[model samples]
Target: MTSRTFAAFLQRSLEELKEQGLYNTIEPLEGPNGPTIAIRGRELVNLSSNNYLGLATDERLVEAAVRAARTWGAGSGAVRTINGTLRLHEELEEKLAAFKGTEAAVSFPSGFACNMAAISAVMGPGDAILSDELNHASIIDGIRLTKSTTIRYRHSDMDDLRAKAREARDSGKYEKIMVVTDGVFSMDGDVAKLPDIVDIADAHDLIVYVDDAHGSGVLGGGAGTAKHFGLSDKIDLQIGTLSKAVGVVGGYVAGSRELVDWLKARSRPFLFSTALPPAAVGASIAAIELLQESRELQERLWRNAAYLQQGLRELGFSVGATETPITPCMIGNEETTQLFSRRLYEEGVYAKAIVFPTVPRGTGRVRNMPSAAHTTELLDAALAAYAKVGRELRLIP
Candidate 1:
């Protein structure tokens, strides 16, 4: 297409989104993403950040980063297989494996890359993946990239999962089968039924992969979802992000020594992409140490989540089946959800609206991520704002 036609098409696409109240404009944050953040010169209670333990700005983590950077420089300079394998990288992997109760661990620059690399490296054209319908975008993309036949089980529906697993196992079309799910669904805050999933996996002799991106620092006494369910030894592959509760930038997969060795040898991302920065790896190690040493932060995080979820429900908003810190205030319709988020921000609460593609078209919501750093006063203030906006929009009484 010519420039004029291409421009017209882009304009039409944007206009369509705007008309449906689905256009998302990025707001620049001026400070650290903490309990409170500055956006457009306004301070708001930050409920959109993934810093669950509030360690993104923790002094110890900062010190660790500074020390590592002073000693090792900023970048890794090459992929892990090359010269990027610094001492900090090995230390971080050892720490992660210990924390996850696994024999070994391998780091990736990002969780998405880890999924892509791990999935594509382990499974391919003749293999099959029984994935959760609500699995993260990265998992879906990774599975797609593997050229594997993917069978999407209904979200958290054991019956659907069993049906799909049975069909896939009995089909005789694939050489191997894997079951993939997020330990905690990011949007709904519900915990995955790992025990049931494990049973199913055992019954079918399938490889079990759990992406505990949202559960690591907040569950299993800070060990993660597998530990939370006391099934650490039973889980095959556990993928987690250092960027979430760990408050650092990177991802890791924890498993048996042989599996980790396989990833280190065959994963393209680990082979081709630069390793995580020295600072990030150092800070992540410190974060894991903190989590393993104390349950205080995790306790506070759950307290805050419970308080906010209860308050919202009392105000008559439908907080979905959340068993974790992610609480979604279900306000149907894209326009209404956007208006709700705008009103909350206007009232000094920085909650974002979830619209189509992130969620189903008519199931738009305002997702609240309550963190350990948010004080009661802050939570109360946010609740008041949510109540006000909810009332104004007739979302609640």
Candidate 2:
């Protein structure tokens, strides 16, 4: 097609998205993504950010970043293979290894890249990956990129997983078998049954990979889902993001020392991509240190989450099967979910809608992330807004 025709097609697609209320319009956060943010000249309660531990705006973290930047300069200058491997990077890796209770750890530029690089590097061609159906998009993409035989089981369904594991092991069509799942399902706020998954992996002799992007710093009093279930020693690969609870920009894989060395020698993202900046590395190290020092933040986070979940439930809104700090209020249709988010925004709350492609079509929801930084007064205000919107939309009677 010519440029004009392609342009017309793009416009039509965007128009269709707008008509369906699925069009995403970016709203610039005037300041840091904290308990509240200024958007469109209004201060709205922020319930959409992944800054679970509220360390993004932490004074200590900022100081650490400044200190590192002053000492190490701005950028790392190249990939890890070249000059990017700074002292801060090594320190961060050591800190992450200790945090996750692993022999060693390897850091990557982002969690998504870590998934893409690690999955593809370790398993390829004739290998089979038994993945959870509700795994994160990054995991799905990584599995696809590997060109491996992918078998998807029902979300957190051990029975289905066992069935698939049996089939994969008995088939004798692949060299290796692996099980992939998110430590926590983001949309539904449910946690992966790590103990069950570990048991299955042991029986099936499958390499286990758990992406604890949403669980790290929130569960196990900060270690993650593996630690929460006391299966840290059993699980083979523990994937995590520094961006969420740690309030930094990067990802990592914590596992056996051999695996870390192997990934350093093999993972394409680590080989080709630029390393994380000194500032981010320093901040992440500080975050991990903070998490280790106290569970006060984690306790407050859960306390806030419980309060929000209870309030939403008492208001007669369905919170689905949330087993973690992530509280998702289900609204059946995509249109309703989007409108619910917009209405919440209008009411000075900033919870975002998760619909259609993010979740299944009928499982659309407005995911509310209650953080430790959120004060009781702020939460009360947000809950009032939710109550008003629920009533207006008839989500609650």
What shift in Å separates residue 112 of candidate 2 from its native position after superposition? 0.6
Lowest-lDDT window of 10 residues in candidate 2?
18-27
lDDT of 2 by residue, 84-202 (tens): 89988999999999999999999999999989988998999999999999999999999998999999999888999999998899889989999999999988889998888888888
Sequence-dependent TM-score of model 2:
0.98
**Candidate 2 Cα outliers beyond 4 Å, as residue runs:** none
For candidate 1, the 10 contiguous residues with the lowest summed lDDT are 388-397
Give all candidates' CA lDDT scores: 0.93, 0.93
TM-score of 1: 0.98
